[model samples]
Target: MKVLVVGSGGREHALLWKAAQSPLVTALYAAPGNPGMEALAERVPWDGDLEALAEFAEREGIDLTLVGPEAPLVEGIADRFLERGLLVFGPTQRAAMIEGSKAFAKTLMERYGIPTARYRTFRDPILALEYLEEVGAPVVVKDSGLAAGKGVTVAFDLHQAKQAVANILNRAEGGEVVIEEYLEGVEATVLALTDGKSILPLIPSQDHKRLLDGDQGPMTGGMGAVAPFPMDEATQKQVEEGILKPLIQGLRAEGVLYRGVVYAGLMLTREGPKVLEFNARFGDPEAQAVLPLLESDLVELALRVAEGRLEGARPVWKPMAAAAIVLASPGYPEAPRKGIPLRIPEPPEGVLVFHAGTRLGPQGLETSGGRVLNVVGLGKDLEEALGRAYAFIPQIGFPGAIYRKDIGKKALRR
Candidate 1:
């Protein structure tokens, strides 16, 4: 079967890699794919143009079209393809509001009694500041709309918290912002495949969101992540029951068939697993970490969901731990300096590099964006995996490249 994977990032690269292993796959294509994905699939230059993509798929007789980024999904690409009687693996535009609009998601969660942080939405700067002052320090400020994973700011002090609110509200177009009560706890990413019903959970993983070492600095897309996170069986069960199930049922009741990956960013607070946010598709670094441990056929599973036959198509996972550490250009989460040449040496055993913001230039790989390559390592445990991940970093040298030193430090302390 021929397939077209959309977007150009580490997540798309990983998807292309996994889908290529399927025996049924005959041809694979990536739209605007990065240099790393060039080896895995044929690279196309389309920037996720819905009509153009659909036309290309039809002309090429593509069997399935897999979306990679949130932009195309938010633009209702799935709905358009479905209208053309094409098979697509993503939720509809209406279903995508779970991630597109934070206010909408919060309302849904409240309606369903799903566990989450207390939050208030505001479009007015003055009212927002008043609420922030009332709520006190250590709150999270989030852009209601998509901001390329850099919109959410977890402020630790009153001054920073107020500034975050001001920055978001004072923007030119002034998008709605959410001020959330910060819940202290370990965070985990749980991605599941569903046909708007029968949910099949993937391996749980934790991501480090801070930009610097020792969990310092501002939030970023993700610095690193580890799969098969050390969550007690009881806590995992609580997340499934208290968070995932209610969410699925609520979406179903709302007549929204979410037939794709449901990514729940949860905080394992003392009260239980409270959702931080809901992403309609897979997480970036989390996808980089989790997909390596998946032993099941991803293409088959995705096809089942697209065909609405996911009842008996549970995915299998390996027992090993997989870690992904992201290497970023200088000044990430702010002014990132690009165009620096990168020198990546031979990867150590059990290590792989998935490119994110890189291009194969005349001089070799060059930094192209804030987050660059995702260096992945697999081992028996988190520490072993982290060691393998770090061992590859020094080999791949780039000027002013930054990464968190404490990739899996939380799991180590636990």
Candidate 2:
């Protein structure tokens, strides 16, 4: 079957790479794909809109369309593709609003009795400030709409909380602000395949958002990640029953036949596992780390979900672990210096490089976005996986490249 993957990032590259391994996939294509994906997929030009993509899929006879980013799904890309009679794997606009709007997600959780932090929505900055004062320090402020993962502020004090609310409400988009009680604990990401009624959980992964080590520095889209986050079966079951099940039930209660990936950003607190956020599509660096361990054919699995046959779809996974380290350009998470030349060498066994922000330049592969590449390593154990990924980082010679040294240390400490 011919497949068209949407997006141009490390997550998309990883999806393309995994899709390339499926025997059911006859051909692979990517729209506005990065240079690294060119080896496996035929690069196609996109007009940078959902309508154009739907038309292209129809003209190209794309058997399946897999969305990688949240924006496209939130903007109703799947609805457009489905209206044109093209098979696409992504949630519709109504379903994706769980990620598109923080207020919507919080409301869903509150309505369905799903475990999550207590939150309040604010459209006026003055009201937000007053609420912050009432909630006091150690709170979280977030933009109700998407901000590419930079809208969140886990403020340690009242001053920082007010500043975050002011900054978010002051954006050009000018949207509402969501302030919530900060849940204390370690974080993990769990992505699942669903057809609205049925849910299939994938291996859990952990992502680091900070720019530097020791959890210091400003947040980024993602810096590094590790798969198989060492979550016990009991805790995983709690998260599935207490959160994911109710979430799907609520979406159905609202008349949405969702068909796509469901991403849960979890905070495993001393009380129990609670949701921090929900993403309609795949998690970027988490996908980079987790997809490598998937032994099932992605094309077939996604098609089954799109057809609403996910009840019996049993996707397989390897018993191995994976770690991914993202290399970013200079001044990333704020200002990234692009167009710098890159020197990447062929990796050894158990290591794979997925390009996130590079293009074919006059000299060679040059950095084009904030995150340049994702170096992933697979092994029998988490320690070996982390070691292999770090060992191969020095071969890449893109000067001013930034990366987190400790990708899987949190899980290792456990």
Candidate 3:
């Protein structure tokens, strides 16, 4: 079967890389894919047109189309393809509102009894600030609408909290904002495959969102990630039952046909696991780390989910651990410098390279976006995985490229 993977990022590259290993897939294509993906799949030129993509899928005899990013899913890419009777994996627009609108997600959680931080939505900045005064410091301020992953600010003080509120609403066209109490705990990601009915949870992974080491600096899409986060069985089970199950049941109760990966950004606090946010598709750097440890046939899994036939879809996972360290351009998650030459070598025996913001230019591969590449390492254990990944970081000559020195520090310490 021929398949099309959408988006251009490290996550998409990882998806295509895994899908290319499936013997069932006769051909592979990527829409607006990065140069790194060229080795595994044919790249298709696209202008981000949903309908046109559906038409292309129909024309190319693509058996299934799997989306890798949230923006297109929030814009109804899956719905568009379904409208053309083409099989696609992702949620419908209405279902995608869980990620598209923070305000909506908060309300849904409130209504469905999903464990989440205490929160309230505001349309007026003054009301938001007034609430800030009432709630005090150590809160999270968020743009109700999608702003990539940089939309959230975990403000430690009232001054920072108010500023976050003002910044989110002061966009060209003012927008809604959600202010919530910041839950203190370790954070981890749980991604599950669902047909809006049966839920199949994948291995939990942790992602580093801060741009600098030791969790300092602003939040980025993700700096790095490691699979099989060190969560006790009780906590891991709580995440699945307390968060994932209720999420799908709630969406179904709302009359939404949500079919795709359900990403739960969880804060595993003393009280229990509470959701920090929801994402419609797979997590970025997390995918780079987790997919490498998966032994199941991804193409077959996607096909079952797209067709809503996920009854006996038990995904198999390798016992190995995986780590992905992101190489970012200078000044990432703020102002990024572009066109810098990159010297990526043939990965060492155990490392895999996936590109995010890159282009094969006149001067060869150069940085094109904030996050440039994901260098993943697979090993017998998490420590070995991280060691292999860290040891190889310097060999890839990306001058001035920024990366976190402690990618798996959280799990290692635990």
Candidate 4:
């Protein structure tokens, strides 16, 4: 089977790597893939152009097309490919609104009795500020639309919270902002593959979103992540039964046959697992950490979902723990300096580098974005995985590269 993976990031790179390992995969291609992915698949220059991607897939006789990002999915690429009788793995545009629009997702959760934070959406700055004053401090301000994963701000004080609201309501990029009651708890990400009926949950993973070490500074895409989190079996079951089941059933009842990956960003509060947000596709650093432990054939599973036969497929996973630490440019989640030369020494036996913001320059590999590469390490436990992950940081050469020294400290303490 010839496979075409879309997008250009660490997540896409990991997907490409996994797809290449499939024996059924005869040919592999990545559309506008990064430098790391070029080594795994035949790199193409289409950066998720719906029509061009569809045309290329049909012309190249690609057996399956897997989308890795949410932008193209929201642009109706899946529907376009399906119109041409091509097997595309992603949700339709209408269904993708669950991730595309924050307000829409929050409304869905409320209407379906899905537990989440108390939130209100506002478009006017004056009205929003008034609401903010009433709501008080220690809140979260989120951009209603995608901000490249840097839109959400968790303010610890009232002054910071008001500024966050002002930044979103007054900025040119920000339109409507969603202010929600802050829920303090352990944050975890649960991603599952669904056929609009049966949901197959992957191992739960936790991501460090803070830009600085010790979970300080502004929120970023994700600094690092660790899989097989310390959640008890009972808590995991509660999340599945209370959150995932209701979400899946609700979407189905709404006439949205949700197929593809569903990412539930959960805040494991004392009450239970309350969803913070929903991502239509896999999480970034979370994918970097989780995919390495998947023991099943990615190509077969994706094809089954595209064919609407996921009920017959059972995904398998490794018992080992996996951790991914992201290496970022000088200043991230803010002003990031680019064009810094990066020298990555030969990886250790079990470590893999999934490039995020990098390009093959004339000199060598250089920093191309805020987050550079995700260094992944696998081990029998979290400690062993984290040990291997942090060992390679010094070997990777990049000027002003910042990384969270304590990526999985929380889980380790638990």
User: lDDT of all the models against the reference?
Assistant: 0.88, 0.92, 0.92, 0.88
Candidate 3 residue-wise lDDT, 1-414, digit = tens: 999999999999999999999999999999999999998889999999999999999998899999999999999999899988889889999999999998899899888888999999998989999999999988999888988899999998999998888887877888999998889999999999999888998999999999999999998999999998888889888888878888889888889978999899999888999999999999999999999999999999999999999988898899999999999999888888999999988888779999999998898989999999999998999999988898888999899999999899999988
Model 2 misses residue 175 by how many Å?
A: 1.2
In order, what is each prediction's RMSD in angstroms?
1.3, 0.9, 0.8, 1.3
Q: Is candidate 1 or candidate 3 better by lDDT?
A: 3
Which of 3 and 4 is ahead in TM-score? 3
What ranking emerges by lDDT with the best candidate at the front?
A: 3, 2, 4, 1
The true-versus-predicted C-alpha distance at residue 409 of model 1, in Å, is: 1.2
TM-score of 1: 0.97
Candidate 2 weakest ten by summed lDDT: 166-175
Q: Write candidate 1's Cα lDDT for 230-253 as tens digits.
A: 888898888778888888899889
TM-score of each: 0.97, 0.99, 0.99, 0.97
Question: Candidate 4, residues 1-414: lDDT per residue as tens digits?
Answer: 999999889999999999999999999999989888876889899855689989999999999998999898888998999899999888888778888889899999999898999999998988888888898888899988877678898877878877877877887765888999999889999998887887778899999998988888888999999998888899889878888878889988898888888899999999998999998898999999999999999989888888888886777889889999999988786878788999988899778889999988889889888999999989999888888889987898887888989989898888
lDDT of 2 at 161: 89
lDDT of 2 at 18: 92
RMSD of 1: 1.3
Q: Which regions of candidate 3 deviate over 4 angstroms?
A: none
Worst 10 residues of 3 by lDDT: 165-174
